[model samples]
Target chain A: MQSIGIDDILDMESRKRAAFINCLSGAKATNLIGTQDKQGRTNLSIMSSAFHVGATPPLMGLIIRPDPVPRHTLHNILETGYYTLNHVNQDILSAAHQTSARYDKDESEFGATGLTSQFVANIPAPFVAESAIKLGLKLVHHQELAVNKTHLVIGEIQTVLLPEDAVADDGHLAITEHGSVAVTGLDTYHELQPIARFKYAKVGQPVELLGE
Target chain B: MQSIGIDDILDMESRKRAAFINCLSGAKATNLIGTQDKQGRTNLSIMSSAFHVGATPPLMGLIIRPDPVPRHTLHNILETGYYTLNHVNQDILSAAHQTSARYDKDESEFGATGLTSQFVANIPAPFVAESAIKLGLKLVHHQELAVNKTHLVIGEIQTVLLPEDAVADDGHLAITEHGSVAVTGLDTYHELQPIARFKYAKVGQPVELLGE
Candidate 1:
């Protein structure tokens, strides 16, 4: 085996970058668009780095960078303990992406993006009406990553909004059929499509071998 | 606007459970299984739920359930100030998943899981040998997701390991080709193929135009 040092590890120019991008290439779930902070100040950002964390507590997480400028949402959430996570479906993918454009702290991305919002009880955050899955997130915890620039926000889902048709009879999420998008870094969208399905336990093994 | 209450949200039923199971359908990325305790007894669990939070501080997070019997890694991470986040590549996927099996407290999952252990300087946790990316994480905060059943553990990455070849000259991550796999709840793996690529600025847009 080749032994390498840390400095050596960091300095080498990579040869596999393109292939690496290709391998993990996925469409950003465009369904969740206009997420807002508790104090009612909002900023638009695009994300493809988001995914599920737990189900029993119905929890999910978002990794956010330090705001480019002072903003109310992050501060509001830290102080008020509530926020909303909205899905960006196909129709609103563009509007959702537009939210990420730098805006004045006092401006609402909802107005610029032209999306509607609703409120949940006990939670002060608002949900986007256009999303296929709307979640009222109760701020549970937040941690600053080592990079010193990102914060991992963990939220306990107090409530969820699902378009009845978006959930299949078997309880599997069919959000893509209604046009959910996936985000990569900040702004890239892909129309999600169901390539195949597998039993939960069948992971680690190939799908075809599992025999449906 | 159609109003819906949190009570109307469906509980975890068999079919609904399966719907969630199905959502893992094609999403795949390899994650480093982490095991650590307050006492500093660390084991490795290589699974992927690890996803990006946002780029501001550039955060990433993952989920872990109580051990099938008594939790060790999760328990240690909660008790101790730190744990290690390792990545599994195509090379270590089998070994990575094997770490999930039950083992005695002293029997390191690294031994059982077919992974080689390498520790980062000044940190107590270990990283996986085959991963293109590995991170050392410090427990920043956690919250009870369910009353007592599940706790969402959030950590800030204190150190990061990225393959020299996985990053582009432009500083963007080109990850898919490095052979990463993603998890649903547990035990599902899929090979990913990149269908397209986009500039960093265009990630979360509506699908109507992007898709066409």
Candidate 2:
């Protein structure tokens, strides 16, 4: 086995270190966060930091990087108090990745990347038209981390849009069935293949596979 | 497309709602968080909320549900200020999932699940012996979310252990090559298949595939 201590990790080049540490955690959810500023300029950026926060209220949390410069996505979300999370499918991988490039506050990533933005359910924010599964979220909480300058933005789900056949009778949505993809580090995309689905685990019992 | 509004979502049964909402966000990184209490009782729990917080200072955050009952994992981390994050691979999926079952505080998940506990560099916390990649972390910051009763525990990377062949020359670790898996919703695990790897994106330029 190989080991990397703190000192050795610190000695690596910045980009190399970033790649090493970022990919170390494992596969991440890939989505395009769409927000519209008060002036109505739409902002779309690729985000892999979004994670499930809770279920009762349907909350999701996203980590926004430290603000050394102005962050258009964060700014727009704060201004409008709403944003859309659009799954990044294989067909839109390149365009979604391109949204990460730094663009002026006035520039819209939708136009820059050739991705269409469509409003849904009368939500002020725009959802990525290319996304098969889209979510409308209303900001409920935001906190700046003391350890890092990044902010944890939490949102409550207000609407869900998906194909009728995407969801199963038991309420599980087969994400891979819709062609959604996963990401590792900053640039690598992976196709998801469901290995197994187990029933709710119980103590002193053998695990049961779903649909068996 | 079928749409689910907030009213319909709120009306579903709790377990079904949990399954639906949890899986809606997308694929998540699956890991086993290992911790030891002051009494030296070790705890292992499957966690999908682990996400990269930052790269420079090398921080990661795990979202732990509120402790209505004693949470061995949270209690141990708070008591010792150290824990280990071990990747969940295909070989350990069943055992890894079993850790989620409610176990008595005195009973170690390691012993019950048949997973070996190995300590390295005297970290005081145990790592899953069968895991291909493991990390030792020190608690840096923790905060309670007001929206949900969950807590976000942030940790700094202190030590990293992986197989010698796990990392590529360019610092990219092909997690899939290590047989690490991803999870969605609550109980579904997916095998990862690499689609494409691209260089960092720049505005107005075509994305170049890695090694091209």
DockQ of each: 0.18, 0.78
- In model 1, how large is the Cα lDDT of residue A30? 38
lDDT of 1 by residue, A70-160 (tens): 6455666677777776666657656666665566666776776687766656667667777766666777767765545566666766665
Residues B1-212, model 1: lDDT tens digits: 23334344335574465345335222334566565565656687654555554322333455655535876767777666677665455566556655655677887877665567777666677777677666666776565544335555656555556665555544455444555444433444444344333432222343243234
lDDT of 1 at A211: 40
Identify the CAPRI category of the predicted complex in candidate 2: medium
Q: Give the candidate number with the greatest TM-score.
A: 2
My TM-score estimates for the predictions, one after another, are 0.65, 0.97
Q: How much is A186 displaced in model 1, in angstroms?
A: 4.1
Candidate 2, residues A1-212, lDDT tens digits: the string is 98898888888888788888998789999999999988899999999999999988899999999767789888888888999999999999989988988888788999999999998786889999999999999999987887878988999999999998777766788888888899998789999999988877777766678788
Span of 10 residues, lowest total lDDT, candidate 1 chain A: A17-26
Off-target runs (Cα >4 Å) in candidate 2 are: none
Best by DockQ: 2
